[model samples]
Target: MYLEKLSLTNFKNYEDGRYVFGRQINVIVGPNGSGKTNLLDAVYFLALSKSAFQNQDAFSILHGADYFIIDGIFEENEHSGHPNRVNPDRVQITISLQRGQRKVIMADKKPYERISEHIGRFPVVLIAPNDTDLVREHSEDRRHFFDGVLSQLDPNYLRDFLMYQQVLKQRNSLLKLFAERNQVDNDMLDTYDVPLLDLGQKIHDRRKQFVEEFLPGFREHYAYLSNESEMVNIVYESEVSDPNFAEEFRHFRRRDTILQRTTMGVHKDDYSFLIGGVYGEAVPLKKFGSQGQQKTFVIALKLAQFDTLEAEKGVKPILLLDDIFDKLDDRRISKLIQQMEEGAFGQLFITDARPERTRELLSSVKADVRFYETGV
Candidate 1:
């Protein structure tokens, strides 16, 4: 599948813009602050129903505009019954946001009952400069990334995760209310606990199983990118790993009441990224690795995400490479272009400030390439 056309209105720096795309490779070239990244974010929004960079939909609206709209046309390559006959399927996506109202997502002019239904219909893998935060930031970042990947692969996982988060929020609020009232209500708390434990255990098991299957691809991509310079591993750490999560939750109740917050669950889980240090000892990448290694690690993680999503969805995902030429080395870019030539990706959107360098890098790839210049 590939995005055939895109339209944006009152989005970020663009008051109104439209562009047609090539199916194979598209290079977006522009000067700094020219909305190159914003253009790519428009595509990401179409795929995921939310902005990748901005948390608020209001921020995406142009400064004096009250709302924003993003539209995309996707083409599916399915052959008809006749000999070598093709009747490509087209999917139209429209997203509109207005002030003080919920955003609307429509597929082919039909609105989705729930926005969550739009996810995974068109999967996209994005790699940006800030992705290293998955390694540099707190455990929450890691959990969010993992959850996002799983959500795209499994709809049930997304529903359960959402429900679990709702229960967790209610449980915490109840604890706060009990503290305010100077009361201890075990039965009231247990009401939330039953659903919490059930959902939490299910989430924990799925995440653990996901990681077990995910690590191999991650390691493989890292080795390919880094040329096996160092051995890296990911360790999944969670209260559920103890095999007695229900009892652990019970044991932590006293402290939860005292703190006015639930103390433990999958919410506290973390994926520790480790690299082999001297004498075969495992060390944290955050403290031990150089900047180059960190970038490579995150890129590898994204590539693994792309692979897994494609395997599960049975469709090649659209790839968004934001300012990657500036962030990655020539060797890595060459490796990526090699994959492009090998037909590893279906549709790719890349943004670069240097047009000549991007052209030089992709000159050897035998794919239909198109360039768009922004910030004019």
Candidate 2:
């Protein structure tokens, strides 16, 4: 699949915009606050039905724009290694926001119900400047990022993921209510627990399997990036310390009553970063690594995520690099650009203000790179 064109209406910084995209490469370049990030956000919103930068739909709309819409024309390939089949003409999405109105998503100009169908079909892997937050911040963020990427590839995993999250939401809401009234909502408790245990267990199992298979590929990229054999840690921290989730549930029942919340299960699960934990290293990457090492490893993780998704889905995901070159120096930037030029990606979109910086790094590579100015 490929993006033929991108159309936007009343989106951030672009009241109306249309751009024909390169089948393999699209570069949006301009000075600071020139809608570079907003353009990337448009692509992301088209693919995921939400902004990659914000948690709220209102935040994605332009300050004064009443509504926003994005449209993309995708061409499908009917011929593959296997026998040929009919291809989808196109899949278009429209995201809208109006005052006192709820956001609605339409597919092919029609109301889209099962949005998940669009996920892996038009997959994407994004690397923003702030992605280092995966290492610098809490473990929960890392877990969510990796799991979300994996879920986008496997619908069964996604089912388990969403089920656990829904159960967690209902459970937390019940706990909040109980805390307010100082009474156990036993009905609410039962309502979420039965499915919670099942879904949580599946989620844990899927994560465990995903990490085990993904670590090698991720580590390979890390070594290639930093030339370090520190064996950067990729641990899958399970929510249930023991296999007996049922027993853990009972043990936490008393605490649940006291705190008015179910404390045990996948809801609280997190994956920690520690090299010495398993490899008996001098020190874990997170603890002793320099800024350079951390950034290299994070980029490696994103690449590995792309590989894992491609291997599982048999389709290379569209890559989005949000100012990834800003943090790295000349040498590192050159090496990374070399890899990217060697067909490390299929379709890519990158944003940055420094055209000279991008030029210096990619001087040897001939691509469909173009420079365009954007501003509010």
Candidate 3:
């Protein structure tokens, strides 16, 4: 699926702008704070119904604006029985979000009940300069990375994930109450853990499967991009701590009652990607490695994500890059742009401050590159 057109009003810094996207690649160039990232965020918000940077919807609206609208037009792929068939009637999805509060989603200009159905319909992978945090930060960061990546491929994972988070919140709140009272909340525990276990297992299994499939691409991407023979690893750390789900569920029974938290399940699962030399002197990439390695790591991970997503979802993902040229050196930038030319990316939205620099780096890629500068 590809977004044929995008229109926004009072969204972020764009007061009123319409972008005609290319099926292969689209580049948006502007100076800092000129709404380059905002353009990309508009596409992401349309596809996923969430901010690209995890920002709240309220913050997405232009300051002092009461409401904002994001409109997207989608066309199904040629492979889907009808090749190159644009819906005679455009499919319009719009979201009218009030400042920091109310939300209403429209599908073909009508209300949408299930948000997950809208996700893979126009799946996109957004890579910013800060994507390196997936590797450099703590396990929670990696877990979020894992969750974000898997959710696009598996709707079941997304649904169960929401359920798990909701139950976890209720359980935690109950735990806090129990601690205050010095007593067990048996009723709360029953309500929370029962559903938590059912949904959490589905989430955990899907994550385990995703990482297994994801690791190969990650290792390959890291090796090629970093130009190292060093080993890379992806492990799913789960708090289940038992062979049988039932056994583990029983093992935590007393604690669940006392603490009022599920305490075991996908909520505690995390991802760990280790990068070091092969059993010799471990060269820390974050510490000793040059900026090139860091840039390559982010690019490679972004590419690997696209590859892994193809297998899981049976669809190519849109690549949304935010100011990547500023973050990458010539070699890494050229290599990435080269891959996009080879069709590694189906459709890409890249932003850069210097149009000339972005053009030169992507020149050899033979893309339909458009150059733009910040306007007063």
Candidate 4:
């Protein structure tokens, strides 16, 4: 599927805007502050039902504006062989959020009973300049990246994950109440603990299985991007993997109450990146790898995500590249360009500050190319 058109109102830095995109390569050219990234984000929001860069929906709203709307038309290819086709030709998805109100997502003018239902219907992969944050940032970042991928690939995983997060939040709130009153209520805590443990185990199992399935594509992409100079791997770590996890979870209740939070669960899981030269023992990529290696590692991760989503969804995902040309070196850029020329990806949206540089880089690609200039 490809995003054919996008319309934005009151979104970040976009008071009002509309764009018609090509099915192959569409380049968005503009200066740094010209809303180029905002346009790409509008597509991401429409596909995923949330902004990629913002934690809260309200943060995506334009300053001084109380609401924001992102609307898009996704077209399906007839040759895709997709089994699930609600609408044969095109689907219109609209998402709107108002200040202090719940965000709403609608497909073809009908609102979904739950926003989760809309996810994975149209999957997207984004490669941003900051994706290396997955390597340098906290464990939460790594978990979030993997969770997002699994969520889009399997709705059941998304459901369990959402339920797990809700339970975790409610349990933390209860712990805080217990701390405030200086009372321990084991019975009340059990109410939240039972379901939390069940969901945590399910999430942990699915995550572990996904990592195993995901590693092959990840390593393959890295080899291509880095010319097989080094080997890279991701290790999934979680306390929930322990056979005694249930007992330990119960044992931590007192400490959890004192701290006013859930101390241990699947919520604290992490994916550690390891890198090493051929025939050498791998070490932490964050500490030992060079800047170029770190960037290649993250890019490979994203490319792997794109491949996995396409394999599961039976349709190539819409690829979003935010300031991608500015971040990669010539060799890496050439590798990506080769993929573009070889039809390794589907619909692509790229942002670049310099129109001339974008033109020069993509000149060799033989496909329908459309260029949109922002801040004109």
Candidate 5:
């Protein structure tokens, strides 16, 4: 699947704009703050139904606008021997948001009852400078990255994962109420525990299995990017790993009641990043890896995500590279270009401040390439 065109209105810094993209490569060139990154975020929004850079949808609207709209046309051809794919047709996706109202997503002019359904239909992998937060920031960030990957790969996981988060929020609210009232109701709390435990366990199992399956590919990409400079490891850490999660949940009721929030379960799960030293001793990458190492680590993670999504979905996902030329080394950039030459990536959207440099670098790539100057 590839996005053939994108149109945005009152989105971030863009007032009214429409862009046509090449099926192979589309390079977005402009100066700093020229909305280059915002353009990439728009593509990310279409794929995942959310802005990658901003936490609030309202922030995506222009300064004076109270609403925003993003529309895209996708080409879906899941078969072979065809220039487009197996089925050569167009799919239209429209996302609109108004002030103080919920966002609406429509595919082919039909609105989705649940936005989660839109995911995986157009899988995409985004590599940005902020991705280093996966290694440097809290575990929630790491969990979100992995959960997003799994949700795109498995709709069942998305359904259960959304349900789990909803249950977790309600459970936390109840805990807050209990603490305020100074009352302990194990019976009422047990009501929430049943589904929490059931779904939490399943989520945990899926995450554990995903990490195991993902690590091999992650390691391979890291090796290729880092030139086998170091060994890397990703370890899944979760209370669900304990077979006695239910018992532990019961044991922590008083604490949960007092704390007014959940202190256990899959929601608190994390993936630990480890880097092997020259002598082979594994240590936390956040604490031991250098700045270059951290950048390399996150880039490898995204590339591995690309490979996994392509392998599982049987379609190459659209890749969004946001100012990556400034963040990655030449060797790593060459590796990415090499992958593009090898036809490892589908449609690509890349943002760069230097158009001449981008042109010189991509001169070796054998694909249909187009360039657009933004914020001009």
Candidate 6:
């Protein structure tokens, strides 16, 4: 499936904007600070139900506007001859957010009971310049990235993840209340602990399995990007891996009470990126890898994400490349362009600051390319 049309109302700098996109490669070119990234983010928001850059939905609304709306029309290829088709060939998805209110997502004018239901319906993968932060930043970044992929690929995982977050929040609140009242309600805390442990274990197991299944593609892509110069590995670490995690969790109750939060769980898990050292031992990529190697590592991770989603969903997702031309060197850019020439991607969107340079770089690509010049 591909996004055929996109309409933005009071989104970021766009007061009212609409675009008809090509099914292949569509390049958005404009000067810096001209809403080029914001335009691409509108598509990302429509597909994923939130802004890629901003954590708050309200920040996406145009200045002086009370709300923002992002609407898109996605069309399936005519030759996709899969049975058991319940929806139509085309679907309209609309996401709107009003200040201080819950975001709403509707498909074909029908609202879903829960936002989680809308996820994974139109999976998407985005490669951005800040992706290197996955390696250099804290463990929360890595956890969030992997968890997002898993959530999009598995509905059961998404359900359990959402429930786990809810229960954890309630549990933390209870801990705070106990500190305020100077009393520990062991029985009351047990109510939240039971499901939290169960869901945490389930999430941990799925994450371990995902890392194993995901490593092959990740390593293969890294090899292609790095030209087999070095080996790369991801180590999934979690406290839940302890044989007596349940007992340890119970033991941490006193500490959790003092801390006023749940400290040990899948939420605290981390994925370590390791690259082959000079002597063949794996070393931390964040500490030892060069800038080029770090870039390649994150790019490889995103490409692997694309491969896994396509394989799981049986449909190529919409790929968004945000200012990657500015971030990647010529060799890396050539590799991506070669992929475009080889028809390895479907319905791609790229943003560039220089229109002439974009044309020059993509000149050799044989696929259908349409350019949208912004800040005119």
TM per candidate: 0.94, 0.91, 0.88, 0.97, 0.96, 0.97
Candidate 2 colliding pairs:
34-374
Give the candidate order by descending lDDT: 4, 6, 5, 1, 2, 3
Better of 2 and 4 by TM-score: 4
lDDT at 269, model 1: 95
Looking at model 1, the pairs that clash are: none
Candidate lDDT values, in order: 0.89, 0.75, 0.74, 0.93, 0.90, 0.92
lDDT of 3 by residue, 113-184 (tens): 877766665667888988888667776777777787777767788888887898788878877778778887
**Candidate 6 runs further than 4 Å off:** 77-88, 277-279
Report the number of clashing residue pairs per model: 0, 1, 1, 0, 2, 0
What is the Cα-based lDDT of residue 242 in candidate 5? 79
- For candidate 6, write residues 1-376 as lDDT tens digits: 9999999999999999999999999999988999999998998888778788998899999999999989989886443333456564887899988898898899899998999887887889999999999999999999999999998899899999999999999999999999889899999999999999999999999999999999999999888877899989999999999999999998889889899999999999999999995678899999999999999999999999999999988888899999999999998998888888888899999999987888999899998999998888
Q: Which stretches of candidate 2 lie over 4 Å from their true place?
A: 79-89, 185-188, 276-282
Give the winner by TM-score: 3 or 5: 5
Spell out the clash pairs found in candidate 3.
Answer: 78-83
Off by over 4 Å in 5: 79-86, 277-279
The CA root-mean-square deviation of candidate 4, after full C-alpha superposition on the true structure, stands at: 1.5
- Worst-scoring 10-residue span by lDDT in model 5: 78-87
